[model samples]
Target: MLEVKNLYKEFNNRPILKDISFTLKDGEIMTIVGPSGAGKTTLLRIIAGLETKDSGEILIDSQAYDSGKVGVVFQDYNLFPNLNVLQNITLAPTMVLKESKEEANKKAYELLNRLQMNGREKQYPYELSGGQKQRVAIARALAMKPRILCYDEPTSALDPNLRKEVEKMILGLKKSGLTQLIITHDLQFAENVADQMLKVQPLSEG
Candidate 1:
């Protein structure tokens, strides 16, 4: 289970998140909805250990939040512009996890196939469409095999048709029993994929 209690965050003395609390059970999908500046991404960053909370606690399965235990698919996809799809996905597994090149390539092949990105392995990020790039990003995250996956603004850059496709992909992940946290402004996408919904109200200044 993932549990966050009384989380607080501030940047340059300006509070972005305050008193945030939530829990996500294993294999559950949670969608966080809020306005653009309401810190939805910040919350996900905190959970993924990319950013630190000023106060409170985050626990994953009763242990402290560890970077190795969570994976994040950033809003911009964040794939390496110079790396081909296969290289992009395999980089972290080999560099961070120290998996052998052969093992990493095998895992990347499986993930690419599962994400329906088989033929695009040799293509760089620029050669792919927005949806394809996002899929590569997701594949990269899954390559880490983290216990929890978090997506920020996953559908923001996609058209309606692509949004639906991504939505289906998320549902597929759920069926695979992966615990997920999605931060999206798309209500329909949220409704389709979220097992639970969280609304992060804008923090009021005193």
Candidate 2:
């Protein structure tokens, strides 16, 4: 389970997220929706340890938030431009987790196959389509063995058809019992995938 309490954030003395609180149970998908600049991504970043929160408490599975236990898939799919898909997925596991090359490669190959990205191991980020890149990004995150998976604007770069494919992929993850947190402006996608949807309203600077 994930618990966020009294979350607050600001930039340059201006409030962004104010007193945001929520709880996400295991095997559930929660989507945070709001307009751009509403700090939806910031909330995810804070949870992912990419950014710090001004004030809040985040607990994952009864423990404090840890980068190793959380995985984030950014909107741009942030794969290394120079690395092939397999290398990109295995980089973190080998570096951070200190897994051996053989072990990391085995896990990466299995994840790629599960994500239906088996044949693209040797392909560079530039060669893959948008959806394929997203899948690779997801596979990289999964390689981390994170207890919680978060996505920022997952479908913003895809066309309608590709969006549906990604949607199915997310649903498949949910069925496989992964806890997920998604930040998106795509209402229909949220409605289709979210077990619960929360709107992030911009804080008023009265």
Give per-residue CA lDDT, model 1, range 174-206, as digits (tens): 889899999998888898888899999788776
Highest-lDDT candidate: 2
Best by TM-score: 2
- lDDT string, candidate 2, 60-179, tens digits: 887877777888899999999999999999999999889999999999999888898888899999999988999999999999999989999999988887888988999999999999
| Alpha-carbon lDDT of model 1 | 0.91
Clashing residue pairs, backbone N/CA/C < 3 A, model 1: none
